[model samples]
Structure formats: C-alpha cells, structure tokens
Target: MIELREHERKTLLIVERLDGKASVEQVINESGLSDAAVMRAALTLQEKKLVKMKEKKQTIAKLNKEGKLYAERQLPERRILDVLYKMGGEALLSNIPKEVDISSNAVSVALGWLVKKNWAVINQKKGTIALVESLLTQKPKKGADEKLLELLAEKDTVVIEELDKNPQQAVATLKRRKLVETKEKSTYELELTKKGWKLVKKGLEVAEEVTLLTPELIITKKWRETKLRKFDVTASGPAVYPGKVHPLQQIIQRAREIFLEMGFTEIRGPLVETAFWNFDALFQPQDHPAREMMDTFYLA
Candidate 1:
C-alpha cells in the first residue's frame, strides 16, 4: 500500500517478476534496465516502503524471555507484606531485544534489584518463574473438545490437518482414552460415541476467554476488546467529520478510481490466492524479481 516513485515502480515490476525477491543483478538483467537505473530503482522502492533490503548477510536478533518473566513479578516490599495472597508473575530474564525488544543486561539488573528486595528469584537452569502462592496454570477442562477429537479419530476426516493445528490436543487425548475408535477412511470416516459429544460439551462450558490489547488494536476486530470501553455519552464520537478513511484504504481507493478513469477495469480478488493469478496473469513469471510478501500478496 506504500506509494512508489517511477523508478521504484519499475523496480517493483522487476521484483514481482522475481517473486518479491531479487538480487541487484537479477533486477537489471530481467528488466532490461541499466545497472545504475536498477540500483536507483531499488533504492526508491525501499524509500517508498515497497521494498526492504536484506544484505545477503546474516542478521541476528536478540530475545529477552527472562526480562519478560521477571517484570511480570511484583514490587514494593511493604506492599507485598500487606497482601494476603499472590498469583501469577510476568516474564523472566535472558530475553534479548530480538525476543521482545528488551535489553538482557537491563533486565538482569532489574531482576537483581528485585531479588535484593526479596520480591523475585532468579534461577537460570529451571527457567523458574516466581509464581505467587495462589498461582495455578490451568488449561481448559473441556471434555467436549475430547469428544470432537474422538469423532475425528476416524481415518477419513477431511480437515484433519487443520484440526491438528487448531484442536489436535483434545483429539489426541480422546483417542488415548479409547472412547471412539477409527473404523474407516474417506467419506466422513468416524462415528462419535456417546462419550465423545459429552466431552466436547463439557469443554465448551469450561473454555476460558483471554484478551490481549495493544495500542494499534484497531487493526483487527478481535483486538478492539483490549481497549478501554467507554459508556459515558459525554465522551461521544467525533463531532465534525474527519473526512478521512484509513490511509491505506484511501490510497487504494484513489488508485482504483484513477485506473477506472483511465479505462482500466479493476481486478478484485483475495490477498490469499494462488500465485498464478497474482503474478503470471499480471505478466510476471517464476523468475520475476518482485514476487514477495512485502511487495505483493502472500499466497499462503
């Protein structure tokens, strides 16, 4: 959705031809463009945010899991003494910036400070978290999920792989219990025994609802729950029209309008589709330089 310069646009075409990724020479050779022109095009592509450069070199990112665990721990020795009960803590240390964008040294220092206050403990070997006396890590106890798994144990379930990724654990647990048996392959293979449905129903009742919100939560509907809900009519909606849609939507709409005005019919499809429609139909081939998720749609 980023805008591009003429040079960048050319580079984009070349990169698309290469499947969203290409080396410097590849862009030049494929575009039939000069070397300098290609380099300038590539730079322009990067400037407009349509392209990102990975310098054929190894890149290392740090992750600070320990820091995260530790920070989730509590504070203030006086306040801690007043509390009757305690529960779960936050992240631990050894998390580098790559993991959660935190510095390991800073995290370590903070933990040390906490330890001095008798607020937290540090044990690198066990990856230990100082959970409070009330802490309990509980997974859902939905026996219903187990039943769905039992039905799915049949050989011929169509969406087996999906179930595995999304609901496999319950399935495996049910199968292990021997409540439902796999009898056949193909054509809706398994039959759910009385036990299976019962398990699934039980699971549905006990399922927990977890919510995570971020500042940019508006990007997804599910994320909206993370924001503070306001019922005060005094804090109403915008009084005057902002006269703006999301920037990406606005730009894309303008582009479509321009193209329509120029007598080009708009082509509409999902961002998730086969590579053929996204690239080949657009005059790009397997070797094209520009076929990449950043520059184009990700087929998967």
Candidate 2:
C-alpha cells in the first residue's frame, strides 16, 4: 500500500488521467495548484519511482525597448536610407542629420548599419554617403530585421522553433543589436513509470501528514491524533545567506569604535564643502595636483 500526501496524490492522478503523460503546465491548470507546489510534488513522485520527468528546452524571443521603438518608428538605417533616396540618392555624412529626423548621436549608428546591409556605401575620404547603384533605380525593400521586428510587434513574442528561415536568421542579428532578447526556458513533462502503473492498479490512499508542529496544534492536543511525517535529516535544506554589514562599513565602524574608546567624540559634518574650505583652507594651491579634477571629487 502506498500512502501519499494530498498534493502528490492529486498530481499523480492528473498524470494518470492525462494518459500517463502530461506537461507541467497541463497538470498545473487541472490540479489548480501553484507551479512551485506542483513541481515539488512531481519531484517527490519521481523520487518514489512513481513517475519520470523529462525536460525540453524552448527558445522564446521577444522585442526589448529598442526593438519596440524601432518597430513603431522604423529602424535607424531604414530611416537614413529614405533620407538618402530623397537627397538624390546621395548626401554628405554631416548633411544626413539635416535631411532626416534622426538624432545626431544615432547618425553614426545608422551609417554603420547602412553600409552593413549594403543599402548604402560610405566614402570616408569624401565624407559622403551614397546609395548602392542597384538601389538608385528601384526603391529598397524591407530587410529581414525589419520584417522580424514587425512580426514581433504584432505578436509580442514568438517561439524560435516556429519561425521561417529568413526571420529565424534575423533573430541573431537583432539580438546583437540589442533590439530583441531571447530566453532559453525548460518545460517539463511527466510520464508514469511501470511501478507507478502497478501502484495505481493496486490503489493508493491520500493521507494528511503533519510536517510541522505549531503552538496551536500543541495547545489543542490535536498533534496526538495526526500522523507526523517522517523526515530525512541527512537531506540538504535550502541555502541561507544571512545579511551582514558590508566590509568597508565594518572597517569604518571598527575605526569609529576604537576612536570612541580612546575618548574621541564622534560628530557628523556637512557632506558638501566649499572649495575655499576644502582646498584653500588646507593650504592647497590652485595649481596643486591634489586640486586637480582627477585627484579630487567635486560636486556637480
């Protein structure tokens, strides 16, 4: 006979009803339990040789802040290409900002992308940008990055496994540009073991076992009627990191304590001091190296 905790029993029954195989998400929805609770019970079942758990790696892709912004306003390179086309298919590098609504800081960034995508070429010696001869005869179409951004904007997120070749290839470039972010997540599926099937056939009992003893239970004498769950003391517990003072702060505190013990009074001073008192009063000359910006901290 197998005696199981309520949550463990519920998870096992759901897995059995799911035809001996079900994802953790499916069990979570059907069992009405938190994912953590469900996972804990599933692990316990696995330890008892009642179930086998398998993990699958899934890559999920989504647009970040920059990606979302570019999706709505268009990419910096595409915007520059439009400006170049309007400027008779060429313009001086410095003249790009005047022709486009792009920021001065983003001009260089856009120029780099334009050259990389082969939409435009940079004449470094002439300090000018010119569209590719092929693009001069026809309007340039959207690239893979642009298409992928639009798709992510519409769907919010996409599973990498489901993407077509072009968009899938664009994911790597978009990731490098910080426009998109991808996360690798693990999804678990549970299947009943042979021993699990045998136990199910013989039937099992769900028991409420006490893993903790509280003051209320002791006061009410209810502990006498409840079964105390067996515990394995040798099993490792969750890691604990107790907070302590920072090393620098500890050193400062010890120094203060030593001074106090030596009959020195501790006092607080102004955080901001004028240069007259900070440097001049200390006899530091205007040309003194200590008064240099690199050597001293200054208030903005």
Candidate 3:
C-alpha cells in the first residue's frame, strides 16, 4: 500500500477522475485547492514517481499607461494624418499643432510614424508635411499596432497565441514604444504513469500529518496521535538578500546631515529652468559652444 498526505491523495483522485490527465487549473477548480497548494502536491507526487508533469509557456500581453491613453484617444500619427487630410492634404510641419490637438513633444514621433507607415511624407528642407495622394482618394485602414491597441483596450489582457496578423512584430513595436508589456506565463499538465495506475489499483492510505508542533498541540497532547510530516534536510532554502540604502543616496544623506551640523540652513529650488533663465538671462551668448545642440541636452 502507498502512503500519501491528504492533499496529495485528493489531487491524485481528481487526476484519475479526469481520465489520468488534468491541467493545474482544472485540478484547482475541482479540488477547491489554492494554486500553490495544488502545485506543491503535484511536485510531491512527481518526486514519488506517481505522475508526470509537463510545463507549457505562453506570452500574455497587457497595455501599459501610455498604451491605455493612446487606445482611448487615437494614436499620434493617426491624429496627425486626419488633420493633414483636412488641410487639403498638405501643411507646414510647424502649422500642424494649430490644426490638431497633439502635444509639441509628440509631433516628431507622429511625423516619424507617418513616413514609416507610408501614409504621409515629410520635406525636411522645406519644413512641410503632406499626406500620401492615395490616402486622399481612399479611406485609410488601421495598422497592426493600432488594431492591437484597440483589441487590448476592449480586453485588458490577451494571449499572444490568440492574436492574428503576425502579432510578434506588432508586439515588438508596441514594447519598444513603451505602450505594451509582455510577460511569460507557465501552465502545468499532469498525467498519471503506469506505476501510479498500479498504485491506484492496489490500496492507498491517507493519514493526518503535522508539519509543525505548536504549544497548544503539545499542551493538548494531540501531537502523539498525529503523524509528523517528513522533511528533506538536504533541500536548500530560498535565497534572501536584505534591503539597504543605495550608496549614492547614503552619500547625499550624510552630506545633508553634515551641513545641518555645521549650522547651515537648507534651501530648495526648481530643478529645471527655461533657456532664458538658464543661459540668456545670465548674459550667455546664443552662439556660445555650450548652447550648441551636441553639447547641450534639450528637452522637447
């Protein structure tokens, strides 16, 4: 006869009832056991050579903050194209903001995507943007990225396998643009081995086992009636790394404390400043090398 714990016995019975093959979720629902508990029992059964476990990996996609916003409002490129179409199919790049509600920072991004998707063209020397002539006659269709965004908006999460039209490329583009995120998910399927079936044909016993000996149990003398659970001392425990302050933050804090001890008062000001306040107001010449594009970091 094979000896089993209560949860293990329950899991095996459910697997057998499922025709010797069952998914972790199926067992979880039928047995009313938590995911972790079911997985633990499955692992123990595998260790005893009673069952075989197979793991399948899948990619799940979800929209991030930017993706949600873009999905609600049309993408920047799409909005720009609509505005250009309204302006007789051509407009100066600087004049687009007056016609559309897109942000100044997003104008460049929209322009890039417009040219990339062949929906519009940009004249860099002339500083103008024009929609493709074909778009003027025919209604433009949504790109794969746009379609994926709409799908994600309707449903918060989607499995990559369920998507059509070469989702891998679309997912990669969305991920690069910081609009969508993908994570790997694993599902386990358990099947009974011949040995497992033979054990089922014979008889098995499940006894109440105690993993911990508490003071109440000791006082009540119940420990004597329950079987103590077996432990594998050779197994390693989970790795732990205690948290500590970052080195740079530690240095900054120490400097602040030292300045306070020296009887100095601390003052705070805005971390960012406009060009006038940062350079022009300080009598810095516009032609100065420090103000050049390559030397300076400019915010859009």
Candidate 4:
C-alpha cells in the first residue's frame, strides 16, 4: 500500500487521458516526460498493480472507489475538516451543519450516512440533536462492484477503462496486500488474497482505507512525499507556470540582442496589416480584405 509520488501520479493521469489506448510515445508526449522516464514510471505502476496492461501496446492505471473518494477529498473544492475534540469513536452528521461550510449534498456524500438517500439514524436527547451512521462503511454503489467482477472474470488481462472507479491513480488504500500466485507448473499469475476474495465474492465490505496525515508530518519540508497535499484554495493570484519564463520569449530577447549588435535598429510591423498600409501606401485598390475588421483591427 505504498503511495505514489507526484511525478508518478502525473504520468498515470496522462495514460488515463489517453482513453486506455495510448502507446508509450503518446504518454510521454502528453505527460511531458522523457522516453526513459515514462518507461520507468510505467513499469513501476504495473509492478505495483496500480496499472494493468490491456494489450502489448497500451497501459492503463486504475483506481477503485476508495481511490476516487480519496482524490476527490484532496481537491480544494471538496476538502473539509472538523475539530472533534470530544467525540472519539463516533459523531453525528447533524452536528456538521453548523461546523462545515459546504452544501448538504457534499456533507451527506462524504459522511456515508445515507442509505437509499435516507439518513441511517436521527436521535434527540434533551435539546441536543445527533445523526449517526457508519462512517467507515462503504457507501452503496449501484452495480459498480458487480460490473468490475463481470469484467475481470471475462478477461485474463483488464484495461481498467470500463471500471466505474477513477482508473488513473495509484492508491495506497487499495494496493493489493497479497498478490495472486499461480498453481501451475510452467507459469504463475496474481492469486487473490483472502481479503480480496471475500470482498469480491461475498456481499461484505470492509472499512474505508483513508490515511490521516499527522499535523507534524504536514509541517515537513516536502510533505507531499508522504502523499499529503497542502492546499490554499483561498490563495490569490493568477495561474502559475511553476518554473522560469518561456523559451520563445528567451529566443526573441536573443534576436533583439543580435539585431542591436548588427548596428540595426529593430522595427516591427504586422504580418498582414490593414490595406491602408498594405495596399494604399503601396498604390493598390481600397476594396481589399485587409481593410476589413475580420482580417484587421480597424481604427473606427
């Protein structure tokens, strides 16, 4: 259950966007990864079982329901927290109404309190009110697991594209605890773990595998190394490039320097300007397309 690195996650996302049908070249291009780097990450993901090979030509990283939920909570818009200093084991969703600043839809979904869109429990003691549900329990997914089992049983190798889960992340939560092993003489394959078989076959679900990052760990210099993301959704500024300036601008500056060195003052003109200059100054007809605002910015 090792969490993937940030760069590894980027590569995985590229493969997912390729629609479970990308060559390594396509992955490298979209991910802005070098050929060597992309290959290395792909092999790592496959070995870790976060990604599975569909064909010899394509690779796809898959995420279960747990993975999707984890990633979703990490996003700025969906993220929330509470200071539960009193309640050690259990709490109520009704208490969340005043503590959290999100829509009720988001609160209900995150709490796992609703069964058939109904709150599992509602209690009133004195003037205080509380609602309770098994927060660690799995939210009922409509045929999501059945679909996965049917697909897996049909094919020896799965692309993970048709999976209802977020098939783009390497999750620490759902990493195979015990890999499937072959009982054959010549070859070996992934054998289901005791935990895995029970989950897939029986209608039983274990607790959620959410990892809580410690406050001390979050203060670490590179906390993201521990798969904890720090977000300031409230931070103000335009989008960032996160690196140095553009290479095209650098080339232009160099050209500017080269022109100055050649004892020539640089002058700029449009590639296709108005007919007032393009044709009128050059002694041509006035009814040119260059005079139109669609092709040129008119002074009117």
Candidate 5:
C-alpha cells in the first residue's frame, strides 16, 4: 500500500501500460503530460525506489537556414561537378567561375570538396581540372552527403539517429560545409524496479482526494475531507537575476561620464582606415606585431 502523488501515479500507470520501459518522449506523448511534469514524476518515483531512470546523451544535428537553401538547390560541389560534366568532363579551373553560377566565396569551397571526393584532378601548369572515369561515364552517384542534403530539404530538422544512412559521415561532411549544427541533450528512459512490479501486483489505486485546499473546497466544507499538500520550506526557489547594463558597456559609459565631469573633451577614431592613416601617421613602426597581417583585418 504505497501512497502516490497524482502525477507520480499517472507516470507509473503509463510506464506499466508501456510494458515497463519507455523513453520520456514516448511517455509524454502517451500520458498526455507536459515534459516537466513527466520528468518531475520520474524523479519522484526514483526517490521512492519504485522506478529507475537511465539517461542517454545524444548529439542532435540540425540544418541551419543556409543549409536548407543548399539542400534545396544541391551543394556547390555537386553543382560544380555538373558544370564540369557539361564541359566534356574537363575544364580550366578559371573557366569554372565563368561557367557556373556559384559565388566567388563558394568556388574554393566547391573545388576543395570536389578534389577531396576524387571526382576531379587539377593540373597546375595548364590550370585545368580532369574528371575521373566515374563522372565521364555518367555513373558517378550521390553518396552520404547528397542523401543527407535531400533528407534535410524535405524536413525542417532531423536528429542524427533518425538518419537511414551513415550518420557520423553525413554529420562530419555537412559540418565542414557549415551547413549543420549539433546540440547534445540527455534523453531519459524509464524502467520499473522489482518493488514497482510488486506494488503494481498489489493493485495501486488513484487517490480521489484533492491535494490543494482551494477556496471552493473551503466554502463547501470539503477541506476537512481533502488532503492538503505539504509545503517544503527548505526547498529552493527559482533564481532571481536583477537586470543591469552590460559590464563592458557600463565601464565605457562610466569612463565617458567621468571624463565629461572633469571638463575633458571626448575624441573618436576612425573604425575603418587605410594602413597609412592608422599606422604610419601615428608613427607606429611598420615591423610592429599589430601591423602583421594575422593581427588585423583588411576589408576586401
């Protein structure tokens, strides 16, 4: 005769009906309970030694906006391959930009993947790319990357586990293309303990009495028969963070305010300027570390 909360009882019934093992997602769908409620019930059951919760952390891969667009139109590499095939399976590397609709930024990306796939060979001296036998024979086929692209095109998002192909290979390739992002989260699976089975065999019953002493129950003199939920004074409450200005911004603003209060004039510098104006004019040595190409950004 184990006493149970309404939510805990609901969870147990759902799990028992589910053949003693089910994912939190399945329980949520079958039990029609919110995710938080299901998790809370599961936690409570675990504490009572009636059920065990096992967590499997998985990394879910999802396509971004640009990925969706590329999936719809095909990857730049695939398109470039098509362009090369149309040119009799060979073309000057420079001619690809002229023949294909791919952007300048994407040309290198497409070429890199194309060469990496061994679909084409670059002749540095002649600046020409020679396609392999597969492309020339019209027998080259779509691999994991192409399949993933097609799958993503039809769906807004897909977990890596749902893929019918090599998930790791697909995720790795798409990640290099900057087409997908991964997020890791723990997925919980609930299982009944021996005690839980014993309790179930003993016939657990749902408590008909309400836990809250509502105003209606009090007015109707039903509060005497209803069970009031016990409050845990030691339980932690939700954290509170008072909003404030960003730390760096606040510091800059305070510095400006102090300068103004001291009768000082504030000056601004050009964010974008020629090297001569930014360095030479300031008498900064040309060999200074900050003048190195890696240290500064140059607008193209």
Candidate 6:
C-alpha cells in the first residue's frame, strides 16, 4: 500500500475518470483544484511513479492589440483597395495617403500587399496606383491573412494545426506584418501507470478542509467533525513585484517638479512646425542641409 495526501488522491480520481490521461486544464476543471495545487500534486504523483507527464510544444497564433483594432476596422490594404475601386480604379500615390484615411507610414505596406494580391499595380513614373483589370472585374475575396485575422478576433488564440489550409504560408504572412504573434507553449498531459489505475479504481473521497473555526461550531460540539485547512509555512509562496512607474517617467516627473519649484515654466512646441519657425526663428541658414527635404518632414 502507498501513502497518499488528500489532494493527490483527489487528483488521481479525476485523472482516472478521464481514461487515465488528461491535460492540466481538464484536471483543473474536473478536480476543482487551483493551478498551483494541481501542479504540486502532479509533481508529487510523478515522484511516486504513479503518473507520467507528457509535454507537447505547439505554436499558437494570437492577435495583438493592434490586430484587434484592425479586425474591427477593416485592414488598411482592404480600405485602400476599396477606395481605388470607387475612384475609377486608379489614383495618384500621393492622394492615397490622405484619401484612404490611413496613416501615411502604412501606404507602402498597403500598396505592397495590393500588388502581391494582383489587385492593383503602381506606375512608378506616373506616381499612380491602378487596379489590375483581370483581377478587379472577376470578384473580390478576402485573402488568407485577412481570414486568419477575423478568425483570431473571434477566438483569441488558435493552434496552427486547427487552421483549415495553408497554415504555414498564412502564418508567415501575418507574422511579417506583425498583426499576429506566435508563441511556443508546452501542453502537458498526464498518463496514469498500471499501479495508478488500479489504485484509483478503488474509489476516493474529497477531504473536508475547513478554512475557519466558528464559535457556533464549538458551542454545537461539532469541532471534532471539522477538518482544518492545511498550510505549509516552510514552503515559499509566489513572489510579487508591485507595480511602479517607469524609471524614465519618474525622472522626467521629478525634473518637471524641480523646474516648477524654481519658477521655471515649460513651453511645448508642435510636432509639425513650418520652416519659418524652425529655421527663420532660430536664424538658421536657409541653405543648410538640415533644412533640405531629405533631412526634414514637410507638412503638405
């Protein structure tokens, strides 16, 4: 006969009910044990040669915050394509940045995907983007990347294997765009040994664990019937790192406070300032390279 703790016995019973094999998620749901408790019990069972833990590493796809926003609002590339179709199937490259209402930085990304899908083509000399007649007239369809994003939005995360088709290429495309991120996680499944199965088949019961002693229980003389909860004072619990502001932000705040105390006022400048303020106000040379188009951002 082997010695078993209350939690170990409970965990074994749940695993036995699951046909001798179950994932940690399944065990947690069925056994009603906290994650730490279940993991501790699994380790104890493994040491006793009662259960073997098998781990499978799987790549899962999940949408980031930006992806969620994109899912709600159609992708920038799709929006660009829609606007191009409405505007006689062609538009100047410069007009697209303002017309599509998408960030100027994303224009190139949208154009690249538009060309890749054969939905549109860019005329470098004319600085215009035109639809591919052969593809535009046939029909509009969502690409694999867009489809994957919609699916991920519905389900926060999905295993690569669960994808319908062309998972590798589809994931590669989304990964490149940074719309979705992939994480490798180990999924653990516990298998019961012959000895464990036999032991669990004998049946088990949930132990009574009381959290508090009440005066009513003592008055009713039911103290002997109550089982107190077990606590391991020697075992270290989880570490906690309290929330704190970023070091850089703290330093900036302190500097701001010091300046105010010294009767100094801070003035903020607009991000997009004309050359008049940037160059003329500072008495900078107009012919300086820093004032050139290559070195400066000009507001249209």
TM-scores of the candidates are 0.19, 0.61, 0.63, 0.20, 0.71, 0.68
**Against the unseen true structure, what C-alpha lDDT does each candidate score?**
0.46, 0.90, 0.88, 0.46, 0.84, 0.85
lDDT of 5 by residue, 94-190 (tens): 8888887878889988888888888888889999987887668874688788788777677756777656658678888888778998888889999
Q: Write the per-residue lDDT of candidate 6 for residues 81-184, one digit (tens) a residue.
A: 88887888889999998888778878888889888888888999999999888856754788778888888899899999667677667878888888889999
Expressed as tens digits, the lDDT of each residue in 1-300 for candidate 2 is 566788898898889989999999999999899999999999999999999999998899999998999999999989888888888998999888887787887888889989988899999899899999999989778988899999999999998988889888999989988999999989999999999988877876666789899999999999999888877799999998899789999999999999999999987769888899888988988899988889889988
Order of the predicted models by lDDT, top scorer first: 2, 3, 6, 5, 4, 1
Where model 5 places Cα greater than 4 Å from the true spot, the runs are: 161-165, 207-209, 219-300
lDDT, candidate 1, residue 275?
77
Ranked by TM-score from best down, the candidates are 5, 6, 3, 2, 4, 1
Root-mean-square deviation (CA) per prediction? 34.2, 11.3, 15.2, 24.3, 12.8, 15.3
* Candidate with best lDDT: 2
71-97 per-residue lDDT for model 4 (tens digits)? 334311123222222343234557665
Q: Which stretches of candidate 6 lie over 4 Å from their true place?
A: 209-300
Where does candidate 3 stray beyond 4 Å? 17-19, 161-165, 197-300
User: Candidate 2, 291: how far from true, in Å?
Assistant: 30
Q: In terms of TM-score, how similar is model 4 to the real structure?
A: 0.20
CA shift of 14, model 3, Å: 3.2
Pick out the ten consecutive residues of candidate 5 with the lowest summed lDDT. Answer: 204-213
Q: In candidate 4, which residue pairs clash?
A: 180-190, 180-191, 181-191
